[model samples]
Target chain A: MRDLSLHIIDIVQNSVRADASLVNLTIEISGEVLIIRIGDNGCGMTAETLQKVTDPFYTTRTTRKVGLGLPFFKQSAEQSGGELIIESEVGVGTVVTATLGLHHLDRPPMGDLSETVSLVMSGNPQVDIVFTCKDDKNEFTLVTTEVKEILGDLDISMPKVTRFLREMIEENLIELKLKIE
Target chain B: MTKVKSLDDLKKMREQLQSQVSLRVNSETPEKMVQVKVSMATCGIASGAKEIMNLFVNELDRRAIDAVITQTGCMGYCFAEPTIEVTIPGKEPVVFGYVNAQKANEIIEQYVVAGNLVDGIIPANYETVKDQKNK
Candidate 1:
């Protein structure tokens, strides 16, 4: 992935493919660390599968021979002096977390998060997505269910509605960025 | 944010409303709305398809154009990494090659918005499924 946002997208996609109905993506920036957490309530993997998930050669998908998403993320996190942890229960769900050194030279930029979230939302309108971002300066949460309430019969995937959601997320993140600076 | 009613209830409501507006659903099909497919295979991503995909979604939304944008696996156009296939309503799909941010903007403005063809169109190298069947 070119950026952390892209990694987040990839991870969340795994959740969606796993038949997850609810996915939570959270990004946080502390003093010197940037943390990304993705949790999904889907069919979780077994201990064996979870152990081998970070291996690029192991994948459950029949269409592809290799699965690089988790491995690539693990590599990036390690290169940036960070750590990655994945916890799963066969029937419950899975959670993946990565913490990267905020100013590390190897750390890729946090790319366009609003666009990533927007695409994920539009692609899977039936799934519920909750995105939260926190920095030292501020914190905000965006829930698709809230937006759905505001737009009674209209689909959240509608162009106008998605545009509104993207702008709302981008604007709030910009405000947080400004405050952090 | 505020608490929401049960999702099951909301889904039922949507189904009821959608049934009432079945015509609207028909109107939203691929033949009507603009369809954009960004190549997102490993090769495509290496060539920056992710950024282009992001750009397409944001720009199209900002312009208020009703479009369905999606990502697809490689179309064997590695040379044209970051390829995008655009199909306007009732029109054959057009695949564009080597699209950068500037080229993407031009596509959105001249092709998607104004209905005027821009540069960078890649000719169809293969026959369509319908054509093959007809043959």
Candidate 2:
């Protein structure tokens, strides 16, 4: 993946592919910790699927099955002196959390998060995404509901929609960073 | 650190510096400025544009090339993402796609400096603006 945000997008895609109707993504960056939690109201995986999710070689989709997204995320988190935890209940839902030591030299850069949110929103216009980003000084949240209202029936794939999403994320992050400083 | 009073002050200072720098570096000088645009759109980011953009900025700065790098929104070619548009002022702008760090380096060395086209160009049909209206 390109960076932490892109990796999050990849994992969230797995959730979308699982037919999730609601996906909640939270990113918390405070002190020396960067934590990301993604929960989806999708068909929860079975024990077999959960066990093989991080195997890097098993997938249920008809698409290319060499699954590497989960493993990569797990490896990245651990390498940064953190951990990846997953919980699922069959017929209920699934939640994946990845924590990284923000101060660790091995930790990958946060990358371009604005693009990540835009891509996910554009690709899965039907699914709802609640994205939250928090630092010690500030917090920001965006719900697909607000966006949909702002862009009525307009194709999310349109350049204008993508630009709006990117600007929203970037402007919020800038404000947050300024508050921290 | 002292903060600028207003944007107007910043603009004035920028203009002053611009003039001085222009005088210092004439067009006849061998050191030509290179401008690189990274496609940081949704599609490009999914295809690893951020990494490639960072690689370009870091490598060019480290090498001390007279370059300035920035990002732009989507160019409408989602399939060939991680696209990069390079402009060596006075020459035509070229767009390259599917860029990684390695490909970014090649573009800087081969295309930016040596004036050659690399692989992974999206066909003209997919270009966002049909004509060079902005240019």
**In terms of TM-score, which candidate is strongest?**
1
Report the alpha-carbon TM-score of model 1 versus the true structure. Answer: 0.71
Off by over 4 Å in 2: A178-181, B1-135
The clash count for each model shown is 0, 0
- Which residue pairs clash within candidate 1? none
Q: Mind giving the per-residue lDDT tens digits that candidate 2 earns over B1-135?
A: 433132233234444434543564554231256667666544566688756765665566456455545556556555677888777867767788778778888887887768887887665555353244334
Instruction: Identify the candidate with maximal DockQ.
Output: 1
TM match of model 2 to true structure:
0.59
For residues A1-181, write the lDDT of model 2, one tens digit per residue. Answer: 5468767767777687677899999988868888999999999999878888888788564323456678889999999999999999887889999999988989888776876676566556668899898987788888877666544433343333444566667776776672121
State residue A5's C-alpha deviation in candidate 1, in Å.
1.1
